[model samples]
Target: MKKTINWKFTLILLTVGFMTAVQYNSMKNPKERDTRDIWAVRHELAVEKQLHSELLSEIRELDKTIFTYKSLNDENTGKALTETVDKLYSQAGMTNIQGTGIIIKVKPSAESEAFGIPVTDVSPDLLTRFVNEINRFKGLILEIDGKRFTTLSSIRDINGITTVNGLNVSTPPVSMKIISPSFKDSEKLYSYLAASTIHDDFYIDNLILEVGKPERFVEIHGSPEMFENQFLKELPKGE
Candidate 1:
């Protein structure tokens, strides 16, 4: 019992310390932007929105855990701590998810194929914008080309090839799986994505965005990489 209590307390302290470091960094290093194009500004806004949403979600989760810890008896403390840890892992994209959601397929447009026009690679900017829009509805777990999309994941172009989570996905016929909180939400997301202008955005690039119908069973794999506190060091002990 003593060991269990010590472990849980240590875990909570470590989590709090990490979050404090993140908060300090955010306060210390504010983002600066120069005169840029509309697309750049839009992308920045989207990224900010996504970060804000994630922070709020995590805050809620932590608050719930704190309440649980305060009220939990010794008999149930272990079980509650285990459940909280599992939930945190799932939210961090460390666990595969099977739930209600939809699949989206991206490929070359028929017109491009028929006209023999070379299909361009997926634009990293455009893909990021689309992800931002998808996040607006919330309750989403996304995976692209079998790579899970986590908060730390990066979608960028290296030598003209787009990569998500450091894996190449610039080619056509890319598959994206999204797991939603419920079937109803998945259906709504399908309808929303189907009507989104992102489809037109892809069409302009000779690519197609096909949003699939809602499914009760959708699989989203976990992220392969783990989050690390690369920059943070242990704080000096209090006097």
Candidate 2:
């Protein structure tokens, strides 16, 4: 019993000392630590939104051109043209199908504030895991903070600010919209994430994930820039 008590006492000292050293290091390099300017991040996001609008304008022009081509084409060519249009819309996220889906909102937990943990921002790693998990469950469409998710979507520390597809999602209580192919898939996602406290330890310990009820007729917009930015031509068959 005496030996066990000594071991516990020594472990406590080592743990306290390690935490104190960490605190000292943080104080030594305060600027090197968390110091992202929210204003700059917001301005950059506005620029991105303007860019998306420009791309949307160009897509509208192309749609008009395609419509004219369809009008003059033979029946088979017209069918192919229609198919191409549908494919582009699907990739661009303009599909207006009625579907059941879920919205997940994340915020810093009360525990984090109580313990003085700086977790007001949702880190890029946590966002990435959320995206990957939703995709794994066959998520048909996704959006973060009103910014559509595409093949080019990414969550990263941009200019010291965590951003999702050029928009700052670092702010707490950001919502992630998940549109599943079916109602069942939406439920699966909720169950998986709900039961994954251990897996999402970093997020759960520092933040709160609020899962919402599945709803129908949820709308998801696709990125117009997805097609506007694509120019690589496919090689002809057997060329």
Candidate 3:
């Protein structure tokens, strides 16, 4: 009888231990899944950004051809030419956007300063992920440190400096202006960004991301140099 009782107790202990392990694994698997998903999204966005840049370049070329032909020969050219130019400028991020929007600022974290850890350049990887996430959340006309974020805009690291649209944003207190479609949209984006783990990501890099309240007249400056297809001028007419 004693032997049987001891065997039953041992079996119960093994069962409980196995159940605990299974529960722990089940809880941990979702975190792994989330990490994989984030990375997969980042990879997809990188590929898509490249494809988008190529496609937009081609589209701009076609538009230039159409514009040249229509402007040179069309009888009712005023309206059509104006519309075409506007569309081209908008797509090229050359037209200033003024409307309701949100501002995001990145600066050195207080904790890092308190801990005597010197602030470092913002990680390109983290910035890319943050930008992609903002785009997904309906952020339009995004300007980072006064540089317009376009399809052709490149954000990368050069000698430990974070370059955005050929401008260095390696320093702290980098400001990002996001012009949304409307006040409601801007508010929604602000809220979404406020609750995002993006802040945590920046914190890991010794920075803090601040999402400001949505406000009116948030202007995003544009660049005339955004579309530099001047070679289109050399193309022969009617070809």
Q: Best TM-score goes to which candidate? A: 1
Query: How many pairs collide in each candidate, listed in order?
Result: 0, 2, 0
The models' CA-based lDDT, in order, is 0.88, 0.73, 0.84
Q: List ranges where model 1 is wrong by over 4 Å.
A: 1-58, 73-76, 228-239
Q: What is the lDDT of residue 198 in candidate 1?
A: 90
lDDT of 2 by residue, 1-239 (tens): 99999999999999999999999988887865545599988977877886797689879978976776767647667666787789778766666444778887877787788888876576677677767666545436887887788766778898778886677764777787788888888788778777865346545647778888777757766554544547778799889
**Per-residue lDDT for 90 in model 3?**
82
In the predicted model 1, the residue pairs found to clash are none
Query: Poorest 10 consecutive residues of model 1 by lDDT?
Result: 26-35
Displacement of residue 179 (Cα, Å) in model 3 is 0.5
| Predicted structure with the largest lDDT when compared to the true one | 1
Candidate 2 stretches greater than 4 Å from native: 1-73, 94-98, 115-119, 202-205, 224-239
How close is every model to the real structure, measured as TM-score? 0.70, 0.58, 0.66
Task: Put down candidate 1 lDDT per residue, 1-239, tens digits, no spaces.
Answer: 99999999999999999999999998888677466999999988988988898899989978988998999899999899799879878978899899999999999999999999987778899889889889777778999889888777899998889999778984888899999989999988988998888999899899999998999898887887777778989788883
How does model 1 score by TM-score? 0.70
Residue-level lDDT of model 3, residues 205-235, one tens digit each, is 9899989999998998886574557556665
